[model samples]
Target: MNSVRTIFQDGGIYIALYAYLALAMIVESIYDNEAFSRWTARAGMIVIVLLIGFRWNTGTDWMPYLRVFYTTDSSSDYDSVVFGIDQGYVLLNRIVFYFSDNYSVFLILDASIAVGAVYVFIEKSTRLPNMGVYLFYTSYAVTHFMGSNRRMLAIGFVCMGFLFLSKERRIWEGWPRWAVPFGIAATVHRTSLAGLAGLMVSRRAWPAWAVIIGLLACLGLGMAGLPFSGLEWLGGTLAQYTGISAIDKLVFYTSGEAELGTDVNVALQAALGVAKRSSVLVIFIAYMRFGNPSQYAQRLYNIYIIGCAVYFAMVGSPIFQIISTYYSIVEIVLIPIIFAEIPKLKVPYILYLLVVPLLLLLTALIPYLELYVPYRSIFSTF
Candidate 1:
């Protein structure tokens, strides 16, 4: 009975999300009103932001974040209390703590930054902003937003960075513009440095054949159990830069207790998700091949390629699942942009409308590692 109730509660949240998506689509497609569409999108955004922001006693990181907030407030020792959180986040928490101990203040601000960033990106960057919002909830919610607050906030900046990077005339030349967002993202979450690196190296799309061959090579190496020294270096660098213990991280990863692992079953699921994400990549490439994509669209395509390369290369590492999930999310916004220019490709929109709901359903049913299960909140009890 408890399980059933939990399922229903989770179902309700999913329904709410899908309702927003459906309404946005209808307003855009049937009403043909961008103004009304934006209004509906804003309303929908509020519903979700409240649902997530005011959430209490739910999400994997909820209590942890609360503890950190309080610890940061009460503790005099900086290093001991700060833990592994970035200075930016810690400072934010301290500021919030200054006024009140209430966690909602922090929650509200965090959610606003995270969700607001994406909302701004969609409104500013995409013609079909509604689709980007739909894709965000369907593709990004479970793996990212449910529990992980700090990184989600960091990702908001990363999304903004993408917007900044997309508009650049010369990718390498516009440092000051792009650097602020990416730099903040990195300071908030060191993993975003990989995104910064991706931007630097992926100035143009690699040949499709090369991408394919590289992906296959990565899979082969992962399956063969060959070590990639680069990943080790990456782990070490991240650890050193972030002031976390590298040996402790390695032990935790190898302890068979990490959320991701080298287990065959985990690998298969990670690979399957990667395969699903590649479908979008393939579509983007196809459009690029057959259509006269704009310069900006082509640049996004190149970044997507780099995302794929990083994803595939991480397959053998314990962090593969995390990297895979991170890379999988870019397509939500990228695909809409790519197809926006090619109006004749009605199939992509059709597929998006049909496919996103399935992904949302999967997210609700699988429960996304069970972190999203038993969806309780401070405001309601199911």
Candidate 2:
């Protein structure tokens, strides 16, 4: 255990996990057997839950959430959640504490919900579940499932809700289906409302050129800080009258009191975001226009493109990225689908494997490695 802890402290655990995912991708690609693909996906999901769920002291919020767990009890009032955390999350703490005050259990429950929902969606919706889970793990393991517990839970519900939106056609069937999950998500994190972008893009299929032009325009808007400059004042005014703690929290962040991650070189991040998002967008849109894309992929792709627009448009806002994340999470499954459908040629496949890790390195690790590296699991310490 001490040796394992040392390895984690050296960041070898992350390297190993990345290698494991790469290996799984290789096997699934080569074996061409249903059982191997299914089991490989299952193994990957279990690894994600265990690694992230049992993380002892990691990232920024470990001690704060631990403190919350320690203080919470069955009688804890949801309305009085500290710092205006959602009632749904406070209730979750109460329920967990009712059975056991062990914080590890709470963490595991969170990992189950956050990781499980996305993986289940991938499994149910995509032909390449292994690749889908790989994308989810690589993209968000540190930033989300390891950091913001409530936001992750909310994202879980949104991911599941998308399943309904992507599949159902009837207004009566689809709206209610997604709304139930969306309601649950909003209770956990108000930003989960960003999931509505999925519904918005679902209304009509815009032309390829239109979305591209719109995205570029949003980039310009963000550069000038048009909407966000007013957003702070607007958020403050709404918080005063509405008395919704969520709005208050939003006001706090946007007011420059707490960055919660908005403090950065906006222009650089936005440009890098363009490189990352546009790469995926090009692949997805190409398939939509030139190839035979399934209705599910088409709808989800539209949502993802809107998510990119949202992110570009709100690059300078404090909490806007959180909103954009709910919309962009669609890519976990979308990218894998696009990858799986690539022509059976070695060059494209090899380039994909090379490009994905490079992209993650550029967009995620370069920016976030220090915050969440030296991955420390409770079990490792033992």
Candidate 3:
């Protein structure tokens, strides 16, 4: 059937991306040259651009975003916040709308900005940029950006700031530096606040035992049937910025009307997924114990640990899980640094080179929360 063909064709591209990176890694291992690695990473960008930029109607929000593109006007006051959209995003959309009405243009532009930002962030920030790109394509790209249109753009800007702050770690050059990007991200999605919270807390040194105790407490609360309905205030506050009213938001969260709450089955799946992914944390730990990383890298590792702690503590709470995701973006830089430094490891590097790829490949085969599945696109369908 044509539907099967579409899934293969579209999904094949992702598989090919994994293959391409695997081949590149093998080559890098043989040659042991930086030039090959850099060029390969740059080449990978071209593939990503093609894969993400050309696709149509593949993401869950594609039609909704298309409708938004058609409906949004360039003539409106740019500074005035459109209840559902960020001011900066509104301005960008209006500017794009000025030139043409085709929704594809917006898609192309968005894909470019997001993909390009990740590329630059990885290339400039990490020694093994290729690994960063590979992890991004396999782990985060389509699932995060394609379906969720606006927030990913904001996250891109936040990523840009994150890279910069990784290099320079002061108020003049660090967290304060990310303020503007974080502000922009908040406008695009209220979830940006979670990222900001992670960044702020990441600077402090939280004891491992204390973090463990806190996690136990949260999990205990979940087991006790807390229902988490009390957190409806947060949703109500977020609704103030969106077109949706507070009463509707309350109903949705409290009544289980929205696909917002997680049952035990979902939580178990999430726990397994987290455990699989958190295996990468071992590499970070190895690096810290054996090799001396730059201060920025250490800071990032700290943030990653904090993120992991938060995730384990709140695994049962979907609201808190969102917060954990924002923090986990540290993996982009962390994974690569771990890989590049594997040579200095006291143990054999072969285990990681074999295991990571297999894990990512397996994950890619699974559907992405019903948001990105079967990989439908206008290019293939029409």
Instruction: Tell me how many clashing residue pairs each candidate has.
Output: 0, 0, 0
List the lowest-lDDT window of 10 residues for candidate 2: 72-81
Better of 2 and 3 by lDDT: 2
Q: Give the number of the best model, judged by lDDT.
A: 2
Candidate 2 overall Cα lDDT vs. reference? 0.73
lDDT scores of the candidates, listed in order: 0.66, 0.73, 0.63
Tens-place lDDT digits, model 2, residues 83-117: 67777887788799889878889888888888888
Name the regions of candidate 2 deviating beyond 4 angstroms: 1-9, 73-81, 174-176, 203-205, 260-267, 358-371
lDDT for model 3, please.
0.63
Predicted structure with the largest TM-score when compared to the true one: 2
Q: Taking the tens digit of each residue's C-alpha lDDT, what string does model 3 give over 45-95?
A: 777766666677676566656666666555364223343455566667778
- Residue 91 of model 1 has an lDDT of 79
lDDT of 1 by residue, 1-382 (tens): 4444555665577666777676676456545577876777777677668767777777767766777788854467656655567777877888888898888878888888888887887777766767777777766655577657888877788777777656646666777666888788776676766676545544455677887888778667666655445445555556545434445455445444466322235555556656765777678877777777666566677776766666666664645435444344566667667756666765656566666455544643353435555556677665
